[model samples]
Target: MRGPEARPRFGLSLRLLALTLVFVLLAEALVFLPAIGRARVVYLEQRLAEAHLALLALEATEDGMVDGDLQRRLLGHAGAVAMTAYQSGFFRLRLGPDMPPRVDAAYDLREVGLWPPVGDALMVLTRSQPRLIRVAGISPKDPRVAVEVTLPEAPLRRDLMRFARRLLGLSLIVSLIAGAVVYFSLARLLLKPLSRLVAAMRRFEAAPEDPGRLHTPSTARHEVGEAERTLARMQARVREGLIEHARLAGVGAAVARINHDLKGILTTARLESDRLEAQTRDRDPDLARTTEGIAQALDRAVALCAATLSYAGSELPSARPRRLAAHHELTLAAQRLHQAHPEIAVNLDCAVDTTLSADPDLLARSLDNLTHNAAQAGARHLTLAAHTSNHQTTLTIADDGPGLPQRARDNLFQPFAGSARNGGTGLGLPIARELTQAMNGHLNLHQTTPSGTTFHLTLPT
Candidate 1:
């Protein structure tokens, strides 16, 4: 019965695209942090160098100092309110106002590490208000000289903001590019093929018996290809099984339709044979025995026909379980085997005379089927061994029949298709196993090898 078709709430391709963009942005952040820090350091150094050049203006003057108006102009050009320089402890230069408020924050650019600049850069971006910051660095003109500059943080912050915006814009572009690349790689390689497989499965599920609905596998060498190939093989096998079962169903229907006619013929034969036996009873004693044999054979044929009918209907008579002596039952089974195949030796081994709860008729029929099958398989000797333990009785029927063939082992207990020998019914083991199950027991093909085959039948005791 069909209920509803399925739809993905969130498509896999979309999820892949979203994740690709997110990961790309994360990667850009990693590149941006250190890059922004390095940029900040460069800006500070550039200001210090400009401040150094402005102090050189004082050096140009005869008194190593400049007028107030000229100092203000130099400070404005250097983008710092104050500048100081010291060299060889003799040459000292200071410019701008005497004091530039109280210093708020200080930085040393001479630190030889990445983390410090990164930390300072992050703090600068997150700060709500700007402050006057002092930056000290080695002098660009002379190695022994040291230069320092004090400037408002507002200009530095503005330059950083502009760089960040541009970097973010480029990151967005890169994210789109990366997402597109992933779509081509992951979506086409994985998602598309998986989607095809899902669609094929849905179509097959709708009409499984339709051979045309089978999926066609692609030639890509990947997990998706392997899955497609596996699905293709599975679909082919399931179709074959369904076809085989359909043929079996047709055979069953045909057998059912002919059942009445077959029954009538067997009944007529039995009655005629019985009459012949009665008429020849006193006339010819020897002929009477032959006629009696004919009647008994006809009775067997009729019973076999009934069994066939029941098998075709997939049912069995209700089992009547009762406690029976195990040794006695084994002896009876051995006798039946000997009678059926007089050439075959029948061995009965029951070390302990245990009690078993099983239907006598079902157990007898199952054993007959087993022994008869063994005989057909070239078995000359059969063992009916019984062992009881833990309230369970295990009856093993072993036969030296050159073991079972590969085909028989592969399709063991499969009705109509299990027989290894030509002209065999193939229903013997299946019928016997079904009967054993009806009697609340199990019949298993325990082992088969080149030497012999063992069938284990377990029943409650």
Candidate 2:
């Protein structure tokens, strides 16, 4: 009974937002690697340029020398513990003050490659203790030889740390912006529509007959729009089906009441016909024949009323199964049909000698309905054939009358709508089918053409 608002914590929206954030951060990480590497290289290059400029003071002096105080100031200003210049194949120590005892790492800017800086940057970031490192690069103004400098890693590490913090902060901001854009865009385009569809389905399930639950579909020309259109059509069909079912139920109830009255009237008419036949026998042959025909008509009317009531009842009669010869049932139905319509010929061709486990009364009634329909359709010749094959019994009833018209064929098994002849109640085939199904059997129209119509009934052996 979970409602739409009771969606789980890790629902679609949260998952979509999380996925968007992850993808945005991943893209930012790609840019961050090269940016950090470039920053480190630029920081070291600036230090080299400063150290070269500091050496210019020595060149200005008459003896190419500087006082200790001036040298110390220059070294401190250049951010290097030691500075050396390689000019014209001669390496000269230009400045040195409080140099470290050992150099932990060395880097040559001339050997710099696209990817080497990224690896070097990562190495610097991973270090724990500060150590002295040597860096060599050609002076920006004078490219004849290289300027070399020794510096502690602590200052560079601090600068890199500051740059990293800024980059991380910037990446987070960009990721948030991008994630928000993607999440909202997808929610509008897909998630919101999908949520609406789910809610509609839940509401529809609660009360399918309610027309208001069916929403007007979106006109978007995408898959989500198609889904909405399909759902709308399905809901519309379900509503139509429910209406039809309720209408049928009402019809069944009315038919039950009419059938009850009709049966009582037919029974009284049958008794009167019997008395009239007794009085007219032998004294008036024509009058006796007329009374007999009236009795027959009343009998058929009573049977039809009974069958209609059976079908319209809340439930079918429970099956009373017994082993009986299927051919015997067919013969009995044919005999009864022949008695009712003596003008028509009923030919029974039962090749099946096997017996079937079924309700004999229901089976006979179904066959009787089929045969009666055939006789009423002005069929001159009716054929009832029974056969057995593969542990099943099949009974086929065929008639040589005008085949069912288009209207009757369209609703051949629908009560009151499948009447082949005018004034027919159209319940024969439907009752037959219902009864057959109640006994775990099938009734199907085998064939229907201008020449003849055939119905096949199959039952388990």
Q: Which residue pairs show backbone clashes in model 1? A: none
Model 1 per-residue lDDT tens digits across residues 93-204 = 9897765557898988888488788888888888869799999988776778789899999899989888888988998898888879977799878888998999889888
| Segments in model 2 whose C-alpha atoms lie over 4 Å from true places | 1-6, 88-93, 97-101, 245-461
- TM-score computed on alpha carbons, candidate 2: 0.55
lDDT of 1 at 134: 92
Error of 1 at 376 (Å): 15
Off-target runs (Cα >4 Å) in candidate 1 are: 1-4, 87-91, 96-101, 140-143, 184-205, 208-240, 256-411, 416-461
lDDT score for candidate 2 against the true structure: 0.88
lDDT of 1: 0.86
lDDT winner: 2
TM-score of each: 0.62, 0.55
Per-residue lDDT of 289 in model 2:
97
Q: Looking at model 1, how many pairs of residues clash?
A: 0
Per-candidate RMSD, Å: 9.4, 10.4
